[model samples]
Target: MRPCPSPLRPLLLGVAFAAISPTALLAQQTAPIVLDEITLQAATATGTIAAPAQPYAGGQVSTRTRLGALGDVDVQSAPFRAAAYTEELIRNQQARTLADVTRNDPSVRQDAPAFSERDSFFIRGFSVPNLDTLYDGLPYIANPRRSALEGIGRVDLLMGPTALANGGVGRVGGTINMIPKRAEDQDLTRVTTGIASDSQLWTHVDLGRRFGPRKEWGVRGNLSWRGGDTALDNNNAEVGVAALGLDYRGDALRATLDLNASKQDLDAPTSLFNAAAPGVPIPDAPDGDINTANPFEFHDSTHRMIAGRVEYDLAPATTVYGAFGASRYREDFLTSNYTITAPNGDAINELGFNPQEIEGRTAEIGLRTEATTGPVRHRITLSAAYALNRNNRGEFNPRLLGFPVAGTNIYDPVYLPAAPDLSGLPRADGLIPFADLRSRSVALSDTMSLDDDRVQLTFGGRWQEIRTRGFNTRPGIPDFPVGEQNYLYEDSAFTPAIAASWRIRDGLTVYGNYVEALTEGPMAPSVAENAGELFPAVVNRQREVGLKYDLGTVTLGASLFEIRQPNGITDPASNVFSLSGQQRNRGLELSAAGAPMEGLRILGGVTLMDAELRRTQDGAFDGNDVPGVPRTAASLYAEYDLPSVQGLTLNGRVMHGGSTWYDQANTQKVSGWTRLDLGARYAVEAQGREIELRANVENVLDESYWASSARGFLAAGAPRTYAVSASMKF
Candidate 1:
């Protein structure tokens, strides 16, 4: 691990002072504040505006979520598989990003290097891009690579395609949505300070207040900063974040506005490695905390976003809502790529730099109405969504003997000399337009309730249109009109979904659903025989059946699902890319959450999947397991409050995955691994202020292993690391 720096002392001291000052100020006030009463009354109220659901008994997970157009629904009533992690869970675990919050989910696997600029995940045997994530029902605000959590209130994960719910242009795996924090009716002031392994230090402040008569106006703000050496040798990271939210509530109208800005810088970021040579045996993973990239290799990113929403009740049974959001993101990075050349950890490395910028806007409008027709109650919704994204990018690459850099051994790392000078090489000083995309969709849905709301049925459909154009941004290439570029792909599809749920008893529900999804097709690469050929959009079909039981304090769910989609592949002999194959994934999932006993809480599940490649180019790889998918995976997390010590809790988690193949032929493989994490938290009253301290250790066994194989590459699991934090509220 890297050594701590001298600057960390002042940051820690400042955090401590910030936390204590609030307490002193509160004491000086002439009127004593009754916090418990204010908090309880605010929590019990239900308003027209949407808010995150309360945490379960243990405060680790939530029972309700706003999933797509379904609005806020309890897990037991929704006819699908999903999970919502609450803000309380994030704070207790000190989670920094989405990856940290979803670590205990059995159906998801992260597919990126720990310190890399990008974060990717595979869900239910399919890849889910960060761009697909939504923020408050609008897409394009959450950064796919590294999204800050300071402004987020809840993280919700929905399994399966979201075409009917979120519209087209999504993956079959699922969708992730982040709900921004909103100010409550009560006043709050909190401060937190934390340190991680290898001397990383961080501090954050959160404040919320409601003003005006009847507390109709609310405001909340958060600010945070972290800088120091990371767990990896010679690697360091710095991050800064600021967020603000404002809202208004009235008898007929509700409105909210949110703004955020963040920046991240990493020195010596981890590099990605390709699969080993076909003939050579796969090499063992290197030390988990080793840094192989040169010190100069770094990544820097900045992002800004703003979003607002408003809802008005036209009548007691009718409502209208609208939302608009926009974001701008920029990234500059220089990194090395490594490829194993021999079984003994020999590899070749290359250096390159890329600078890119993206701007996007998204909007939504909807109307909902409810009525009762004699014995049947009906709820109907009509909505439309629109989004636009534009990207600009530039790169610099200097080749040496056909390779970007010299070769080195992975086991015994050796840093390369200074990068070759690129002054003579042609450089693109300014970014050029790379791609532009526009998406529009309209949806209609209805839910019918019968037998005093004991039986419910829902059906929906969406008409989606996607238009995309690409450009040749190469510096020396002859420039052409933006719309006249060689690549232009446009398509439209109408997808449908139907679901039904029956109440078997007071606490158990049985449900099933059939849904379809559509994804943009791939364009053949220039090297392919049918280069530039644009294929038709790919369609995915899914069917699922599940059972959910809510026993007051414990929730249990089980699901079985199957998803099938067309697979595109390149023929070796013809050098042509086409949709010549099919892929299918069938799986079963079991999950449980909430407190089973008075003091013991559990949140986790197991997933068993069978993913296969079928109808390949020549049937050569038919019946083979899909690359990067594990057959069996399980995760378990438990927390217990000690009866001997008030306000003291102990928690632990375990995760395991089965072996996975790296190639379609199944020749290269990575063994499965298990990891353990443990932590403890204690709360107490200090000087009339509530203070809490927490400490956690991940990878407690210090085992080094390969975490996953996705996109034909391997990622190393995180090493043993410690985190300690202290927070005070007034």
Candidate 2:
């Protein structure tokens, strides 16, 4: 048994603060000269984006990634599959959140829009919450509902269960990790402003600099604000984001600190609850510009986080590191649920107001070292982690007054009157205990290489303990009194993982891995008799094999994977919900990213899925395709710089999805749809730097269709929108 690493929260914060305090007094955000193409190329060509290897051919992504205990390894060389999208890509795409930037990944999809209150998704046909996302390789720090992208340097996505890397129960579908930006060798002063859709306007400022004699201290900061009416009628949104990053790098010591805060407000938000009433036939989707929620309805969320890390090299081949993070999230919404009841667009709308708050903290300490034997080289790591989250909720909504329901039409939603003030209810502004989660883990692993490093094999295991407590919950129609309640659930497991990789030849590698994850049980729906009941934790497993090829200018990857998962389901006869359902997703994924040819760059992929139910209510739905799991999904986004026209580039993207069943019984399905988007950009020299103007038209044809039927819920697609922006570098 391996001993746990002591908590380093205090030491990590102290070291980082102490290292950057002196340099902060002398740092200059702006240098004398502007940033030019040559300087930009030199800055990126170095190790600014990735380690050892420069940015890939297209400069949109890097082949190297920071895998949990594995440290940094080549994507192809690592047994698991993953990709790290670069800041260059984020800037080009104008991505506002993780969902906006990850659209290029076929394995990842979301039912919500970028302007929505939450950012959630399905990676490999399994649900993933934004709260599980990581910041700087540590969890419980990123925003709980929506992750901001202002200070993010790279978005790394690892496909499949990563319990072996991130100890304790982890995401079974995948993991998204945001790498923070730091001051680069070259100074930067960039200002960008834009307008979107009918009346939205926004501006952003970015600054970076290095200080001290050896330029070992660095600082980077970003701030942005946006607000206006959107393409959807009656829908208005506003957002503010701020992020600051500090770091220090020496010959043997390195430390970093990151701080972020953001707030978002939305009125008459669309597509939050788009489910059709049971036994009601699916209705035709309204126009893209339609806003289903009433104009008086509103939703708002706020997030704040601070994190720090420090690492020191004890020897050339050995190192010690520690990380700590804390975050707070609060949400308030006076929204209503609208359910379609008939094909004629008739629906029932009910108003419900609830406020939620979540607080989380995580810390870790680890040691890594490398040793060699006569015939092999070994890299070993031992680490320990602790994470805790406490969730609280308000009891002002239905507990005191039953929310009333009204009839409406989906095609032409009748605006409702204003909601009553919430300040009157006692404790309406206060919060009651809802749920708490704590996870403690110790992990150790080793990677061995032989035969000139051509063949490699890795194996590891983690001992993890998960403790959960539950309190108050909103039950069925007639609300129950909200009171102090606490329920405790604890479990422990030893999860093992193994992988093997063979470099068949230069620029090509084949790898496979087997992994498992323990996931929190789903809450029973309000319609079930066991409403709000939490099922016992279940283990999810996956098996994957993949092949990779670097075509110099273009890189292509292919993989086949299988996942088995269990969930809670309601029994119609017994009216009880329990962990009696199982699902298996078997699929093949093909992806390509980079500059395949001169004057061109591409990033997109295709996914084919065979998701089916293995066990269901009394085996009634056995062999049926899993609801909302599309048979095929494909997207392609490409850019071409016209050889005849200098400083001009045109790009277009097309997304297509196959049909999917909407219910477990597979009685009906929503047809697939295709969308097209176009954009252009022009760059010219200005003040010794560069100035770029960009424009884009999304949903070119103004197609109106069901965006997603995930979990049997139907969310309508957003309308066509136009955006244009200009950026200047100094």
Candidate 3:
């Protein structure tokens, strides 16, 4: 798994024949005619020309975005079930995170296992923590455990429950926004290099600029690095990233600023799924890139962020906006915790050390307006938001230091013995003072607009608030009671939303939505029986209907959904875990992205869910079936383009999922899997710059299954890997 050298193939074929020669296409058409006569003498000395960040059609897949605040609208008028993935599908799928751009999202999955240093998901079936991602639309500033897509540009994905558009503290199975990367008006520099599949090694840099005299000042920058070995076995990893962005545009003022930093280190990482001893039967899944972690395990993380935004325009249809963001996160983990004593995979392992630190802040303010009364046509918006989070955790235990760490057998593997000197433990920076979280929201929306605009309705509401506190950094054990007793908890809710769309004509549309989501509840764990109870805060309801079509070059969509929530286990004959469970999920979805002809292109989707679990605890998990819900899922991706090799292009992708259930009484299941991927790209143009080359192979058939599950762990699929990249632009 470490090959591919040979002097980099004659330096990539001498830069692909000096980038399609022809004098580099006549010096790129005379350098844009000497930069358009110095941009027409600076546009006649600044009359104006700053409009540039809205032109993405160079490869389809973009139906407008800003999903979740209903801002940039149009995905057939946005009535929910969003999708957005562009950056040309994350650079034609050479994706480098956000789980590789959600692996072409089919309602997303992957709850663990994928170079795990943190990055979890389950989108339409709950659980999406990575600290609840969002950025640009601001909310704690992205960093859901190692997220780096080299300065991202679009990744919308809004499937359900956003509590009236991002505020009531997300995740009733959706919400993920990351849009950054500005500074365009076209002066850029790009560089990229890559490899991965047991050897790693990648590099990237991108820069952009625009200045004064009407280009309205802007700048962008990104840098990246990745290092060594990783398709498992003895694992190893390293990463670093940096970003900077700034913007300004006048005529009514607009501004932006962003900064970021990242770092990650891993060695023998990947280990999680140790809880199968109640009757053992969950083993089978120990191959694919094996490494039950612990070659002196390690995992580290660091991140920093800053964000800002401002907008103003007090007339021609009024507007005002403000946003702020902040973030700091740190992590350190020592792995190995595998407990599946036999089912052919025998396991016992133990080695612990957890460390964490997090701080976040977010803010938002808004006003938007447009009006008309007698003939409809409104469009109002009012907003407010606040979020704060703090967390610090610590743990250390090598069997409490008597040097006890032994147990292994995930299909025969052992290599322990190098970690017995805790240095007298107590690290994680002398941790103490565990949780604190707060979220506040206020929202109002309107969107009327009738007949002339072909009906569009939208009404929103949000008045959320949630506060939480928890402490007791392990003090004298006994259900750990130190300071904060019943772990203070607070709650509030009011989420409401309604939506409707009906273009019913030019390119078709028909949408409907009803939303609600408000989560954060489920405490009481000291072995149940109401141990430190503090519940109340769980509302998740959604209903949707959709259809969209834009046949002028392909685009289609479909939807029908339902969701219900309420969960809080632990009863065992009155042992009290409260909230008395309940779960429901219903669905049907289908989607497609376009470029139906010349040079082909197509994005894909399919989902079919049904999930259940109606009431538990005394009914013993009632109708079962909701543990890692997966009643079918699908995805496809395609690309073509090659009229006799003019800069090549070819691609493929397919992914599927179906059987899933690993507890909650549904007798344990895990089958249903499929995966395939392939890729290629070329593109050229030399001395004038612009070059590209990409390659991909992801699980092309390595197939070792058991790829999804969450809560009841179990994650394995991911093996046949390979990637290549090359980029240039100046």
Candidate 4:
């Protein structure tokens, strides 16, 4: 076995916690506070608002502890599979980007080379464009961004079988929701600046204020900017984002509104596969300053989102909440001077392509109510969603030659223009430069629970319908060829779920859930006479069993899961294959996070899966492991506050993934590799103000590996790099 790369200042924090005692840590917090007893009277319920007779665990961070479910509820509690990424974890790791938070999730996999476009992610073996981007529980889809994390308070990842709670039409993989920062009491603010090993620099500011009786009305805002070069030659990315929000809370109701916007630019370098030569590195480019004119390129995009939520109480045990959100995204990409190598590794550039633009929008609204009666609890929700997506692309498909139009000489480069229709091909009159689509969905779910203070049983059902329409034709070229289709005649589906949990103790619980979910994909363009031939809907069914263990100071969780789909999409339609078959994914996952001891926190997880295509027309992939998904993956991250030095902490993490095939044929493969990161932070408080200094080293050992590879391109992971940052808070 390869030696574990030791992080700076060694020792995982968990290892140190076992050596300490709770009393030693409890001493850090003030002695348990005791309150004086006094005569108390029942507060009268106000007009039209529901009031609780007692307090609820609304502040519990564990509710949103998974990936994306947004603090709304636990995956086991929701009508569908969901995960929440809490704020504590994000702050501790100094996560600067959306992709950073997912590195440790067993259900979410970031493709390859952390920052690549295709480097996005996959859930349950299906490629997702960054886990169903959402804003305040609404779809927040966008091409890609650099500082997307800065605009979010937390992220909720909802996995497969979500056709109900999240609306109808969506990817088979899952969805993601962005929980924006809300107003808080106290004049709190934080500013942090840092530089990475790749010479990148970043700065961020978060501020919140409260000024009113009840402190019920307040404002919060954030600003972030980062720029720098990475280990990859000619590869660099930068971004800026700003967000503001307002909140109002009253005796019977609470409301909030938020607006956020951001922009990102990237200069992507070509990612080479295999050795540049017999002994050269995979990213064969020379170590020097590179320019756009080189055999590489990149572009930019803009994102904007707006959302609001309102909660009202109707009775002592009932409360109703409503949420609405919307977002817009724009993208432009270009490629020139790329190198197309032959199967023999000989240089060739017989191809070139460019994306003039790609843009889309998403909007959603939902209403939900929570009620309780004695030992029973119930929450019902209704929602509507719509999305508009369009892409105008251009590619040069030269026969016998690949892209980069492979120049005979390695020292020479070629430039290409945006010619999508191959300067006019046969049969298909006019260039098919674009495809447009509009999708709308409506859904509802109801969750009913019964508990005897120790055991809880939950039942829920979701009903949904998806309708989509397609169009084609560019602005100037109104006569352009465009394929149109619809799901108007498709059937609406109802998926039901049941779950039971037994609490053995305060910190441990065992849960078993059986759920069924469904989804519909965007219709692909029709190239044949039958316009509806390629527009069929896809659906899935999944069941899972899991255990939850919270040790107060540390939490441990494990789950055994099985998922299957009766029908899916099969690519390369020319092969005459049908998708009316079954696919399955069975896996075991373990995750833990919390303060193991005073000033020490550790987060780690691992997943082992057996995913496969059980049946298909081709029958070739029946028993083979699903391509592009790892069989086993693991991650470990920890941070320790120093004992001798006040306000200082050390952090480190290592992530590993097993290898898998790249295609259905299983003939080609991408090897597995591990990456390491190390960092530290020092804080000082003085005269009503605070300052922090931080730094991190990424790819500490500079291991070379392919981040991702597909039919047309490959991306490499960054090599060794260092960054430093500083921030102040008031």
For each of the candidates, give the backbone clash count. 0, 0, 2, 43
Off by over 4 Å in 1: 1-13, 16-48, 395-403, 420-429, 475-484, 522-536, 568-580
Question: How big is the positional error of residue 630 in model 1, measured in Å on the Cα after superposition?
Answer: 0.4
On a 0 to 1 TM-score scale, where does candidate 1 land against the true structure?
Answer: 0.91
RMSD of each: 6.6, 9.9, 23.9, 10.4
Q: Model 4, range 1-730, lDDT digits (tens) per residue?
A: 1122223112322322321233322232213222243211122221111111111121113453222111244433333344566665566566766667877576676654454443366676666664355555554343333337665666666666655555454565566656666666567766565656465556677788877887888788877666667655556766667789888788668788888777666676443332121222223322222222333456556766667767665543335556665555555544333332433333443332333344456565555554444445545555566655544443322222233343443223333444233333221121333444455665555455555435666555556554433343323323533332322334456776676676777767787777666555533322112222334455577777778776756667787878886534324224222454576888888887767778777776888888786776568567776656778878888788899999998989888867766545465566777889898987776555566666777778777665444221344565677766555565
Query: Considering only N, C-alpha and C atoms within 3 Å, which residue pairs clash in candidate 1?
Result: none
**Can you give the lDDT of residue 74 in candidate 4?**
42
Arranged by TM-score with the best first, the candidates are 1, 2, 4, 3
For model 3, the local distance difference test gives 0.73
Q: In order, what lDDT does every prediction score?
A: 0.77, 0.76, 0.73, 0.55
Deviation in Å, model 2, residue 658 alpha carbon: 1.2
Best by TM-score: 1
Worst 10 contiguous positions by lDDT, candidate 1: 38-47
Model 3 C-alpha lDDT per residue in residues 201-266, reported as the tens digit of each score: 777777889899988889888877667788888887877788898889887777888999887878
Mind giving the per-residue lDDT tens digits that candidate 2 earns over 179-274? Answer: 988888889977677778877766677899999998889999987776678888888887778899999888668889999988888887765444
Better of 1 and 3 by TM-score: 1
Residue lDDT tens for model 1, 1-730:
2332335446645875565454543442123223442211111112226555778667777878766655677777888888889888889989988888877689998887787776778888887767778887678777747787888888889999887777455678888888888877668888888889887878888899988887889899988887788888778988888889999887678899999988888888886676444545667788878877888777777888999988887765567888889998888776777777787888877776657788888888887766666566667778898888777665322232243567887777788666544344432235666677778999998877789778999999888888877765443435554334656778888889898899889989999999987776665643355644566667789999999998989989999999998876454335566776887999999999999999899999999999999998689889999878999999999999999999999999999989987767778777888889999999888567778889999989987777777655678777889898888887
Task: Give the lDDT ranking, best first.
Answer: 1, 2, 3, 4
